[model samples]
Target: MTVERRVGNEKIVELLEGVSRSQIIKQLRPVGDASSAQMNGGSDNVVASFKELIKRQDETIATLNHQIKNLTATWLHRKRFVKTLNEGIEAERELAKLKQEMAERCQIENDRKQAEQPHIEHFRSASLPAVAEQWQQYQIAQLPNAEEVVVQQLSAQVKQLEEQLTYGWQSFEVQGASLAQTSAQLVEANRKIHDLEVQLAAAMSNAATVEGARSQIRDELRKQALRMLDAMLRFLDFITLDAVACYTV
Candidate 1:
């Protein structure tokens, strides 16, 4: 079903073929009269011995199949782990990019605010006081002996100037409130950026840990494969030695 299974099956077939070839060679070998007599008497015992070897070979194949399944499952799990880790890294990159963009926007906003500061200060420190002084002068000019129509017109002018002054103060208050809100927004953005940085740091730490674990897993898998190979080799040697002993007897 899988490449691993195919390879394992191929290996098992090769091992079986080699064993068959060895048996054929042994069968074809010429025997002395004494060996022939011994073989005739032990024919049943030889069949049982071969059956035991076949059983052991089957058991070895089953063990190998089990190990291969474990290897395949481990490989799949590692693949999923790496995919998740990559996704996390990509997300962190996007977050870093967003943080950079926000910082740039905040810098631009700060620059614009700085540029507008002079005009706002000029308006507050000079314009409002000048308007107040002009209004006081107009009020003083409204004397008891002034002409009726002229007094009425002057009263109307003073009232209009008072309205303008009130409107200007209101506009200044609104601007201050707007600036305060902008400052609050900037503070919130900065806090969010700091939080992102902290998360990025944690993600980096986790990535390092994952890397270490991956390396450890690789080493462990390599050791397991080596151990399996050694066991198989030893089993083959034992089978070969038993076959030789039977032939000699």
Candidate 2:
């Protein structure tokens, strides 16, 4: 099959003559290294390919219309098939997206529930000590000897709370140290991401420069091959519909 593209004549001829899997891989490597957006440019070659497909589709319809001139049924049948196929594909894609969204929402809810659990336990533990002390102290009997001796419970409670505060400060310091380490890791990760992005951009630019030169040669050869096919058909009156339909020419 002849390839039609917007590239140079001589370069097109050279590449087509020597095309290989490795050569194609060489063309693909740069796209792999490129940014998602820039790789899309390398992938524009795909969109360009679609242009030819669309053109050939038009040619096919023309041939069908010309050959089966009496019946409009075939034309309508082809149109309906293409429409139904496109619609089915679109519906499937939408359904997949909705499923993905629901999965993400469920995951977020699970995480929220997990996070609340720890705080719930902490509150229960804190309340248990105060309630127990209140109940037990009320049961203590008053001292004998006609006068009741009063005990200073509030001072002892205050001292115990101070000890707990000291430990709380210690726990806070340990968490603060962990946060400092995490911050350092985040900074390093950002630096690495930046470096990879820069390298990817450079690789893309280099690949584009190489492809530009290589594509020129491929175009020239494909265009000539197509022209030759057309010329051969013109010289002979036996013009087969296959050339117009399947043949790139």
Query: lDDT of all the models against the reference?
Result: 0.66, 0.60
- Candidate 2 lDDT over 1-249, as tens digits, reads 222333445644543454455445555664445354554554465556556666776777677656676456677888899999999999999999999999999999999989998998998899999988776555444334212222455567677767766755665565557556555655665565465556555555776575654454346445555655564454332223323432332
Q: After superposition on all CA atoms, what RMSD does each candidate show versus the true structure?
A: 43.4, 50.2
On TM-score, the leading prediction is 1
Q: What is the TM-score of each predicted model, taking all chains together?
A: 0.37, 0.26
- Residue pairs in collision within model 2: 8-216, 9-220, 11-217, 11-218, 12-216, 12-217, 12-218, 12-219, 13-217
Residues forming the 10-long window of minimal summed lDDT in candidate 2: 237-246
Q: What lDDT is reached at residue 64 by model 1?
A: 84
Backbone atom clashes (below 3 Å) for every candidate: 0, 9
CA deviation > 4 Å runs, candidate 1: 1-43, 130-249
For this target, which candidate reaches the highest lDDT against the unseen true structure?
1
Q: How big is the positional error of residue 84 in model 2, measured in Å on the Cα after superposition? A: 66
